[model samples]
Structure formats: C-alpha cells, structure tokens
Target: MTCFGPRQQTAALQQAVPKTRVQTCNSTPVRADGEFVLYWMIAFRRTEWNFSLQRAVEWAVELRKPLVIFEPLRVGYRWASDRFHRFVVDGMADNASRIAAMKNRGVVYFPYVEPERGSGNGLLAALAERACVVVTDDFPSFFLPQMVAATATRLPVKLEQVDANGLLPLRATDRVFTTAFSFRSYLQQELPPHLAQFPQSNPLARIQLPAMKTLPGTITRRWKPVSKELLLGDVAELAAFSIDHSVGVVDQRGGATAARQRLQQFLERRLAHYSETANEPDEEARSGLSPYLHFGHISPHELFHELTSCECWSPARLARKSNGKREGWWGMSTGAETWLDQFVTWRELGYNMASHRDDYERYESLPDWARATLDKHARDRREHVYSLDEFSAASTRDPLWNAAQTQLLREGRIHNYMRMLWGKKILEWTASPRDALDVMIELNNRYALDGRNPNSYSGIFWCLGRYDRPWGPERHIVGTVRYMSSANTARKFSVDGYLSCYGEGTHR
Candidate 1:
C-alpha cells in the first residue's frame, strides 16, 4: 500500500458539502499519507442517494485518494436466519454489480460474507489500519452504533459518521417528543433550511479518481471478495452459520434494484389510492418499502425527494399550509400527504428518539405517565394468557390476532393496520406489561425484516404508551395507556379478508 498526498478542491466543490451532515467520531489526526479513503457500508447499502457515500467521495476527492467501500456481513446477529440473510445477500448481489461498474472509475468495492460466526468481527478495524480516514453510516439503533463505537476506539486516523438515515438530523433535537403533534411542529419549523442541501444521490455520475488504477496489493491478497454466485439468493449458506434456521426467507427480494421497482410500483399504482386504502388490511395498498428502508437498500431522502418533486408534481402544489397539522403541507393528493407524514415525521421521530437515548428500547424508558398508568393496573387479572410460543405459533384465540401473527411468521411482516392491533392484543393477553414488552421484542426482532429498525421500537413502545397520551375512561389491564379492542378493530376493516389470507391451515 502506498500513500496519496492530500488533494485540493475548488471552492464550488467544498461549498456543495453540508456541515450538518457530518459528525466527527474521534479527534485522531487525519493521515496525510495513506492508501485510500475507506467507507464501511453497514446501514446505507445503496450506491446512490446516500449521504455517507457522497461524503466518502468528497473526502476521497479532497485527499486525492481512491475510495474503498468495505462491506461485510457476519451471520451472527441475534436472529440471523435464512429469511434475513437472503434479503441482505440479495441486496449485496445488487451492490456487487454496482461496485464492479465503479471498478473502472477507481472505486474499490469489497463485499465479504462471513463463512461462520465471528469471522467478520475485526473487518472494519483491519480496513482502517491502512486507510487515510474511515467513514461509515451514523445509524443509532440495533447493533450498528455499538459496532461503530467499537471501531472508533481503536482507529488511529480520523473517523467520521454521516447521518443518512432520516430527514431530521438526530443531533438537531436535544430531547425526544412525546407525541406526533409536538414533533411535527418542531419539524415544520426546523426542516426548511436543511432541505436545500441534498446528498449526491448519484455518486458515480462524476468520475474523479486518484491517479492509481490498482488497489494496495496487501488488500487484494489478504481480503479478496467472495464469489458473486454466493452474493445472490444463496439461502444454502445459512446452514453453515450459527443462527436460527426455523424462520425462513421472505418472498420479497432485497436490493436497490428491487427497492426502486417497489417504489415505482407504489408511486404509479398505489399512491393514488393510498390515503383511502392504506390502513385496510384487505387491500395491501401501502408502499411495501419498510423492509428496504430498514435494511438500507433504499433511503428516505430518495423516496421523499421523488414523492415531492417529479415532472408532474412539486411541493409547491401542496395547498395546505404548514400549520403543524399531520397532513396538508404538501398540498398534494391525500395519499401523498398521508405517506409524507409517515415517512418524514413519524419515521424520523423514532430515529430522533433512538439517537438520543441509550436505553430507548427499555421498559423503564416509557413516558412517566405511561409507566404510572401501567403500574397502577399492574395487578389486574387477564382473561387469557399465552406464552411466547403460543404467540409465535399464531395459536391465539382471536382469528384476527392469529392471522396477524401468522403473517409475521410466514411473510416476515404484518400489515400496518393489523400490526397495531397485534401489539394491543398482545398487551391484553400477556400476564404483565413487562412480559408484553419482552414478547413483542422477541417476536418482532426474530421474524420481521424491518424489526430491528427504530420504527419497530417506536411501534412496540407505542403499545405501552410511549409517544402517546392517556385516554379517558381508563380500561382494565391497560388502564389509561390507550386501549385498542380486537372486536372494534375487526369491524374497522375487512376482517374476513385478512383471515382468509394469513389464517389458512392454522386454526382460529
């Protein structure tokens, strides 16, 4: 490996970068002599519409070093299985092609799949050893923050993290909001200035590489990438790994290509009818993009910019004023407005909460009011109590409840509207609120493709009254923590239709 001297950039290029987007991880000295700028692509998997990738390119250009994207997946996360592994490998399969194309343009892409447990443990540190500066995604939840923290402790050169996860910068809010209204108000007031600076969505568009065409011989000899055949739909690889095998692969494929296809399908066919049928379990009309968003196959900014501004549409068409209301600002169709709220306010709100609190997922972290109410009703009796096994097997008494759980078991996700009822009922049936929380986390994190996301914690904790208010006429077991009745929920939509789809073979 040889060092490339620090390169100079024009004022225009420097000004294009946003200061708010970058967060310095360590104060270690930036190397004046190192092989290349390294990007450890953990969360944001795509090549385009990625702030982290863009920032890496900027650093590589400014330092006159080739960009090295080192992405490795260890088959040892808590719930690693054929299902999750397949989705990720599918995305990597896409990334492999994208990286191969960039090879001609001086971007060195190394995709590694851990052959066994603990194989990829020291990957980032090894890459950082020879690099000028290491840059990675600033994801706050799951094992990502922990992984980056571990790497930051040992790296000698500078390490930087870019928040490419959400529209709201996690650092902007000092505290988490307890409600959607409050966050939306803060969002409306704060987001205007930052919106003007978008990420270099297509990092490959402008080809500016270091003079060197080849990577460090040491890197090539020691860290050769796995075969492309292994990157694509290789479920058989899971058998060699030490993780759960019962939970199976999902039918929906994973990758940037698949994500874009899903997004286009959503915009073209479903966006028009979204507002009306989004919550209806029978219709299956929502964007169907959460899995992609959670895994970083796609980005919120990409989807948001696309939704707000297309050839036929613009945010200016938004007739509704930013009055701190949930909908209307986009002055677009009902579907777009409804989705924008979910995409920006709600999704980012969860991201904001997780980024600030280390114990964001804990039961004790629930709002004071919620904790009080649940404590008040802690001794209340339950008419039905089921173990975690019953829930996982989808053997609950309620047909709707069983159907939702079955959907999770089979499809790796539950429909959004049914998902709420799924949590609320689990609250009702579990012997204790603490037990309910544990159950939700296990079932979700183990099965749902989008389970490890901030939204997953948000939805789970929301069931126990996080980001919510006490309702009138406090009910038993749940008390004032907002009760949802299964019967009432069943009547809200086509219950029979839901039962017909996920309820097959399993008894109600």
Candidate 2:
C-alpha cells in the first residue's frame, strides 16, 4: 500500500466527512504501516445511513486496508441493564448477519458485550495499536463525549469523530437554543443547506477493500467476540451477563431492521391520524421510534427521506420565510408538518443544547427564570410526598401517574402525552423541586429505553420548565412552572383504555 502524506490524508478525510460533521480528536499522525482502519462504533451502531461508518469506509478505501468495526457494550456504565443490553445485542445480531451476508465486503464486524464490570476496558486502545487511523461517532450527550476524549489522548494514531446524530450536524452552529420556537426558526433558516448532505444510505453495499480475516491474537484471546448464541437472543445466554436483571427486556426487538419496520408501519397505518391523535393517550398514532433512534438503530435522515417521498415533497417545497412558527416551514401535509416539529425541531433542540452546554443534563442548566421560579416554590408544602421506592413500585395514589410508571416499568416506554403528566405529578408530589428532578432522572433513566439520552433529559427537564415558560396563576408546589393534573388530563383526553392497559395488577 502506498503511504499518503499528511496533506493528502487530510484532503481525503475532508472529502469523506463534511467539515461541519467531522472533528479531529487528537494531534497524532496516521500510521502509514498499520494493518486496518478501526471504527469504534459507539453511538451510531447501525451499518446503514451512518456517517461514522461511511467515513471509516472512505478511509479504508483510501488506505487500501480492511475496515474493523468494534461495537462494544460495557457493564460498568450507569443504567446497564438486561433491557438495554438485550436491545443493543439484538442490533449487533442484525449487524453480524448483514456483514456475513455481504461476503468479501472487506468489513469485519466485532460485537463485544462485556460479561462483567471493567472487563471491556482498554479494548479500543489495544485495537488502535495496529490501526492506520481510528474513526468513531461524535455523540455529545451522556458519557460518550468524555469517553472519546479520554481515549483520543491515549491513542497512537489519528482519531476522527463524525457527527451522525441528526440531520443538522452538532457543530453546524455553536448557539444553544433556549426554546423550540427560536430553534425552529434557526433550523428553518439553517437546515435547508444540510438536507442535501445525508450520509450514504448503505455505505457498505459497494465497499471494496482488503479483507481482514483475523484479529491480533492478543486482542482476540483477551476480548473474545460475543458468542453466536448471545447474538441470537438466547434467553439463557442473556441471563448469564452481569447487569441489572431487574429491568427485564421488553418485547420490541432493537436494530435497524426493526426500526425500519416500525417506520413503515407508522407511515402505512397511523401517519394520517398523527396530526390529530398523536397527543391522545388511547391512540397508537405516535411513531414509537425513539428507542431505536436513541440507540442509533435508525437514522433521522432515513425517516425524513421516507416521509418526504410519501408526501411527494422536496427541498423546493420549503417555505421561503425563515419565521420559526411550526406549521408552514416544511410545506408538507398537516400530519407531516406536525411530526417534523417533534422530530427535527424539538429533537434537535436537545442535541444543540447538549453539544454546546457542558451542564446540559444538570438542573443548573435550566433557564434563569425556570431556576428562579422553581427555587421560589421549592420549599412550598406538598399535599402528597412519595419516596423514590414508592414511585418506582408504582404505588402512587394517582392512577394515571401509576399507569404511566407501570407502562415504563413493563414496556420500557410511556405514551408521549402521559409522560408529561407523569413528570408534572412528580414535581407536585416530591419534597422539593430538586428532589423531583432527581427522582425523574433516576426513574426515567432506569427503565425507559429512551432514557439517558439528550431528548429524554430534555423531556424530564421540560417538566421543571426547561423549554417552557412560567404560566399565569402560579401554583403552590409547582410555582409558575406549567402544571398538570391527572383529572384535567383525563378530561382533555380519553385515558380509560390507557389506564386499563397499564393499570395495577397488570404486572408484578
């Protein structure tokens, strides 16, 4: 293989990953004599529509080396559980099958599931020792940013982190948006240029490079790839892993395969009613794609493409005005516009904040007015206070809240509308505003599949007035933070069926 100079390498990488989406993590030079290109697949775990993988493939082709994709699951991370592990492993299973089917693709898929705490440590470092260059997902939220940063400093070869998190790159703008309206307006103006920059929908399909038949013996001997049975979703195999078994796996399988199917089902069956019924507790109009999106099993670009194609829409249909008002920007149908608001505006708002603000997940990161209003009402007496245990057990007196919690515990998700009520009730019942925040974080991150994500934090914090404004006629415990009650929710929407579905005695 001919070794390229630093300038040539930089030019090639720029062509592969757009300047807006790529971040050079370290100053280390690429190793000219290295064996392969390593892709540390952390956030964007799927094989398709992934900028990280696309970048890795481009590097492999440029260097005339095979591509090694390392997707690892660590047991020591917070909220490591049977449910999350099973979901991710299912995606690994799908990736393994997909790679196997693509014979001679020159891509090696390595799925590592840490059997115990700290067992998977140093795996990336060991793999990087022989790699020409390392590429990874540039995820801003949770522990990924820190983890990548720490690893970047120790690696001998250059590392590139690609932003595949959303349609708008995380580094596209440095502004941290405080409200959906402002963010929506910014997006309407800024997002059009990025729409044309989608990652390859199937980067692996035409990939051709040197095939890597084996890993270094030291690497394979210590960190063996997960067994075939484990990837096959064997129940007995799952039980043997050391994680939080109490949070049992849900029925929904994870991975790009299931994510695409869910997208199709939403478009075929529920999209027409989405504008009117999405907020209703009883309707199955919501997309239910959050878990998949959170795990990077699917790409927002794929969803947007399918939706626009269904509507016979294009960039030319975009509204000329840059005003942030939600409905008209896309120039699509009412339902499509409504869904895009949540998907692009609201969802990317969280990503924007997470990328710019170090304290995005902290209560202190709330807007000044929100923090002040919450602090003012923090000491106000509560009519009902529940311990975290009581809340976790779904032992609350409010049946609707309990039902939502039950749904979270059993199915790993809550209806979109009910989740708001659930959080507001916690604010109303907990001893203090901070306690409510803590409890919401714990419960949501513990059980919900979408928990521990930027959007999840956005939702949880919204209950304490993060993206919301103070309402008139401030209440006792909630202050000016917008308030919600089960009685009022039931009045506004039919909840009888929702209640019955997740009501007490439904599950242990």
Candidate 3:
C-alpha cells in the first residue's frame, strides 16, 4: 500500500509540485523587506490538509518570514444569509482555535467577519501592503476567478493563487467534459502518474518557524480578531450581522474539526455499505461531508489519500472495467469504488467545467442538443406552473416534490436520490426551461449549505440535461432532454419513509 502518513515521505507522494497547480496572478515582484507572508485564505479554509496552505508555508520558509493567515467572511456576497454566515463563522472559530494552539510555533491567524456590507474585502489589500507575498485558494467558480484577478491587480506584492479544490488540478483538462463516461476514461488514464502527487496534507508537520513580532496596534484595532464568543459557536451574534437571517443555520456544525470527525465516522461505519445503499433515501449511509467539502473545511486529496492508504484495492484487481459497472476500478468493496467516483470524478467534472468555461453557470451554457430540445418544447401547454416563492414555501401539489424542497429548506440539503427528482419536478412545473433554471439556482443557493458550488451548478444543470443525453419517449416541455416522474421515482425507493422524514408536517 502507498504510505501517505506524516512520517513516510516516499518518492511517490513527494514528487515535485506541479506548475499547473500554481499560478502567479500578478506581475509584481516579491517584496524583499515586508512584515510577513500573507496567506489570503478564501475557499479552502482548513489549517491542515490543505495544498494552498502548504504553498504558503513553503513561501514563508523560503522568504525567512513569519506567516499570517487572513480569512474573511463578507456580508455582501450574493445569497448571503444567516445560515451561510453561521456555518462559515463556525469554521472560522475552529480555525482560530487550531491556530492559537500553533502560536508557540509562530504561526498566526486572523479571521474577520464583516458586521456590515463591504467591510471585509479592504482588509486583505491593507494587509498586503506589508506582506512579502500574497497566496490564496485558486477556486475557479462563482465570483472567485474575477475576485482574485481584481485583487491581484490592486495588491502591491506578488499574488499566487493555488488550486486546492480537487484531486485533479483544475488546469489538468483543457476542455469541458460532455459526460461522466468520457471524463472517467480520461481519469482512468491520467490518475496513475498523479496518484502519488498529493500536496503535503499537513505542511506544519515538517516546518520550523521563525518567531515574529505582532502586527501594529493600528491595523489590529481597525480589523480586530474574531471574538471568543463568536468562536464559541454563537449564532445569535452572527445573525446580528448585516446579512439575511431568514435562512437559518442547520443543526449541523461546521469546521475542520467537524469535517475530520465526520470523515472518520463515515470511513469506519458507512464506507462498507456506501455503494450498496447510498442512493436509498431511507438509508443513513451517507458521508454528510458535502457542506464541509463545499466550504473547503476538508480536502478531496485528504479523502483520496486516506482511502488509497487502506490497501483495500490493488492495481491488478482494479484492472476490471469500470465503464458501465456500478463499481469503478479499485478492488475494494462496492462502497469504496462508488465513493471515489462521487468524491473525485463527478465532483471534479464540475470544477473542470467551471475552470474552462465562463458560462458554466449560465442558462445559455446548456448543450446544443439540450437547448434545441428545450427550445422545441418552449410553447408546450403546461399542466402546472409555480412561481419561485411558491416553490420556496413548499406549497406544491405534488407530495414528493414538496418533500424534497422542504428537505432542502429545513435540513439545508435533500437526499441525493430525491435531489434529482426535485429539479425534474421544478423543470416540469415552471413556465419555461429558463424559468426552471433560475428557480433552481435561487432555491439551492438560498437554502443549501452546499449550494453556490461548482457541483451545485452541475447538479442543477444535469436536471436540464447539461451533461446528460436524450432518452426514449420525449415528453412535454423537456423534449429530448431527460425526464423524471414522481410516481416512477416513488416506486423505486421508500416514498412513504422519505415523505415522513422530509415531507409535509415534518417542516411544520
């Protein structure tokens, strides 16, 4: 088995860092005499098991400078709400605690939660004024690409953006994949060489630090460190921030600590049954790690490394075809193979698309066949059409659809099986295909903690046939674009169980 623990640094896992994974967003030369190496933390928020964090540590060592991690939670982003803010703050609190524990080693972290709109962004540029270099997470989705480009231009020092979003670097593929089969084929051939090339999951496990003085009182006063009360997981204080509070936080906790705990439990308990029962709405075999992955509290590389280290599968055994098999490659139990497909290939497919295409989230970005089919049925008579507000309230006539939406509203996520049906019903009931897209985006973004991610758009678009192909018996409105039915989906799973768990009265 490949050794990925802190002690064993074999040639396989210690390969030279790939240049494709790192990019210099600014032309500015690195500052020779500066206060510290600034890690402008954004998407990937974890202290350890982070590629971008590892890059920052290397730069700090090379420059003989102390490292200061700057993380911010802004109130002004699209679909910002109490739930989103609370989840982020909880993670930040976890980060604050971990960083405090590392203070003896001279690593410092400061998280800024904006009390008002436009309060947090200026702090990064302000901190950059004294930094030798600015390194950040190179996530290529939503406003991140544009935000990083703009920040790089304005910062006085060198700005390096590192891709820590997935097992495969976003730049690895040049073209957007049309389907999972094609992407998996590319993945099968490409994964061997890169298997041992994971970033240092715990950079601090090896680094020795130089003690540095604290920042000036003026800067600290202007942008104070997050309070212990906030760090203690107080949502009431967070809700007082100038963001929407209607969408409340879920009962679930958020942080690297929480993520690590969840990962451990899933591996030990649910992994064996993962493939056998992951799609069953009535079963509890899920990892529940999506929100953590979405928030960058956990790393996909970390997940991949832990799984690979198990020695559960060998290359010889994995030679079997994964093309159409429910299980892919890896000689491990059906669970492990199925999980690797979901956690790596499917997740990264969306990241790959977002990295290559600016229109990844746009309605017009749907495939030619999908668009033509949707356009062909644009004028088809609709039996039911509901506005976005009605959908949000879960007042629909269909029990199954209402259950899915309420699941999203109450739990901040829907079961994986029901999520597809949720989108399919929305598409069927909306006035037009475009209207369906808009409503799906709005509801997902506002409610789900895992929303506003590359996968979110991928999942939503999949319902509209983005990465899917035509099916038999083209139906109304959807045309050749694939279709799903409540009655049909209900028969496949325990509909009564699902309805009770997430349907009407469950919410009330």
C-alpha TM-score for every candidate:
0.93, 0.96, 0.96
How do the residues 1-508 of candidate 1 rate in per-residue lDDT, one tens digit apiece? 1111111112223345466768888889779698889988899988987888888888888898888888777777788888887888888888888877765456877887777777665566767887899898999899989978877878988999998888777777697787889888887778765565566667765668874565567655665566565675667766766667898887889999999998988888888888888888844498889999998999887787667543245334544445788776655677887888888989998998899899999999999989998988888999999999999888888878988999898889999888998998899899999999999999999999998999999999999999888897989999998888778987787888788888857432
What is the Cα-based lDDT of residue 133 in candidate 3?
Answer: 95
lDDT by residue for model 2 over 135-218, one digit each (tens)? Answer: 999988889999999998999999999999998999888888999999998999989878767777678876689877878789
Query: Which candidate, 1 or 3, has the higher lDDT?
Result: 3
Ranked by lDDT, the better of candidates 2 and 3 is: 2
Q: For all the candidates, what are their Cα RMSDs to the real structure? A: 5.5, 5.2, 2.0
Which model, 1 or 3, shows the larger TM-score?
A: 3
Determine the C-alpha RMSD for candidate 3 after optimal superposition of all C-alphas.
Answer: 2.0
**Per-residue error (Å), model 1, residue 158:** 0.9
Candidate 1 residue 201 Cα shift, in angstroms, is: 1.8
TM accuracy, model 2: 0.96
Model 3 misplaced stretches (Cα beyond 4 Å): 1-16, 311-328
Candidate 1 lDDT = 0.81
> Which candidate achieves the best lDDT against the true structure?
2
Error of 2 at 369 (Å): 1.2
